[model samples]
Target chain A: MGHVVIDVMPKTEILDPQGQAIAGALPRLGIDQFADVRQGKRFVLAVDGDVTQEHLAQARAAAEKMLSNPVIEDVVSVRVLEADGR
Target chain B: MGHVVIDVMPKTEILDPQGQAIAGALPRLGIDQFADVRQGKRFVLAVDGDVTQEHLAQARAAAEKMLSNPVIEDVVSVRVLEADGR
Candidate 1:
């Protein structure tokens, strides 16, 4: 079986409160010399066979409708990730 | 100048409650024909200039110490993602 990966990130133009929160915490935790930190979500879906264009489209649709909010999230990337079992 | 991507994923051996929840909800939302769904976190860090090996090490350390819990997490990947601004 193959896998499909969905990566969702907030739009740079939009205000990223969650990312800002993390950024605020980083320095307090001793991680200085850091720059902008943007947080996002990743989903890996295992399909029962080789990943196809149809599967990729489905994953993209799922990411848009189910995983991410359109207004705040600007970037969403979809791809196939092969498992180590093979 | 560059970006470091830290991807944290729950250990495959450990129970993934969050992913299970999503898998259970997908069919209800009419998103059938899906397979295993594993959820993770993605952090994109913007650095001032070109990425170096030292930066990658720092990112890895930050990911292990703060971004992910080693007990339950299996995979944490770090890399440099160049920004489009340059």
Candidate 2:
């Protein structure tokens, strides 16, 4: 089966409490290398055959209409998930 | 600033209600092309300097120790986010 990957991230101006909580806990884990953390959603949509332009268009439409909330989130990426899992 | 990306997904054997719900909803959106839907997480960790081997290692460590619940989820990918935002 072919798969399409869609990524959704909270808008830059939005407050991400989950990300903040993770960042706050990192130091306690003795991992001070990172300055910030942003949490987002990743979706894999599987299709019956090889991914085609039409599938991509549908995935894009789905990403916008169903996968993300436009007011608070941005559909950061919409692409095919390569066979080797890029 | 540089960034590292981490992806976490529920183990294949685990039942993903969210994914199932999404799959069930797709047809309702008139997006019946997709056969399955699996939802996961994407995390972007920001750092102040250039991304290095050490940072990658730390990201791997964090992904295992904190970002994912070993009992249910798997850390599928831990890599630099790249300058081009790949």
Highest-DockQ candidate: 2
Highest-lDDT candidate = 2
Q: Model 2, residue B29: what's the lDDT? A: 85
Q: Which stretches of candidate 2 lie over 4 Å from their true place?
A: none
lDDT of 2 at B70: 97
What is the TM-score (0 to 1) of candidate 1?
A: 0.86
lDDT (tens digit, per residue) of candidate 1 on B15-81: 8888888888888767765788989988887778887887787777778877888998844568766
Put down candidate 2 lDDT per residue, A1-86, tens digits, no spaces: 89998889899899999999999998888899999999999998999989999999999999999999999999888888865453
Q: Where is the poorest 10-residue window by lDDT in model 2 chain B?
A: B77-86
For model 1, the superposed segments whose C-alpha errors exceed 4 Å read A28-30, A82-86, B82-86
Q: How many residue pairs clash in each candidate at the backbone level? A: 1, 0
TM-score of chain B of each: 0.84, 0.93
User: Candidate 2 — what's its lDDT?
Assistant: 0.90
* CAPRI band for model 2: medium
